[model samples]
Target: MREIIAETNRLQLCVPTMDDLDGLSALWSDAETMRYIGSGVPWTREQVQERIERAIGFCADKGMTFWTVVEESTDTIIGQGGLVPISFNGDEIELGYRLGKDHWGKGYATEIARASAAYGFDALNLDRLVAVCYEQNLPSRAVLKKVGFRKLGQSDVYYGVHALLHECLPYDLVR
Candidate 1:
């Protein structure tokens, strides 16, 4: 509801737009990316539109949603990193991110995650920030660890190799 926009050292974050459908569809269509997420069939264009609408609604309701992560120099939307809902985990909010294959290993995830976590804590005043990661997602786990989240332990998540639950608190901002 509050129109969240965050700027990090290398990227700018904003709400997902209808124009992002192509990128969202492309990103969600990847087998490697969705391997851990339980998308039975790749999302179509219409589905992407629906996703955008849903994201907007989420922002309207919760005051936040999956934000676009764009390069500061070129303004290219490399990927997205955001805080989204986890209904089963006590309706908890969790950090989520994905970049193109090219953007991997650049510390983009860490950079964006740190900002998102800070926004959640300081602006949103969330009690705890958490991320659910795939067991085999070493890169994602590494990013979460680097950004002040700790492995709270494992959870029986339906999607992924295995789900490792990570969390951080405002009082303990760094790991």
Candidate 2:
């Protein structure tokens, strides 16, 4: 069963199930969409399955994970977004979002980031949330800024890549 954890005007963030493998695979396998993610390479179907399994584990153990993002109008899984322990097991939590090529530039990223931040702060009682994006990922950085994250400059502490780090507190959210 799919659990709806959060919602926006046009999207629903749900706990991912095995059924999401195909949708997630399609999203993660797109070379352009996979750019700036992890190794900056598209993930194979097996890798996508591993991600879904990890997400399920994270949700069960930590009460949060990068949720399966669904377009409410079509009920189609377009991407993933939500809070997760940095690197999947770090002490700090981070808000993250990703969308397929077809969904870019539609303000959906902002919606996901804002809703995820709200969920982290309000629902999860998180004192602060951090986010990281590739230096060249201008649109993602913009989304983080629009959501009220303060840039902490570059850091290689997470994801083994030098990412532009940003942090936000409950009161700093734009919601």
Best by lDDT: 2
Model 1 TM-score is 0.87
Top candidate, metric TM-score: 2
Q: Please give the clash total of every predicted structure, in order.
A: 1, 0
Model 1 deviation from the true structure expressed as Cα RMSD, one decimal place: 2.8
Q: Which ten residues in a row have the lowest lDDT in candidate 2?
A: 83-92
Q: Which regions of candidate 1 are displaced past 4 Å?
A: 1-4, 39-42, 157-161
lDDT of 1 by residue, 30-108 (tens): 6676665544355667876887898888877887787877888886777878888876668688888877666778888
Candidates in order, TM-scores: namely: 0.87, 0.97
Per-model lDDT: 0.77, 0.93
lDDT of 1: 0.77
Clash pairs detected, candidate 2: none
lDDT by residue for model 2 (46-126), tens: 999998999999999999999999999998999999999975546789899999999999999999999999998888899
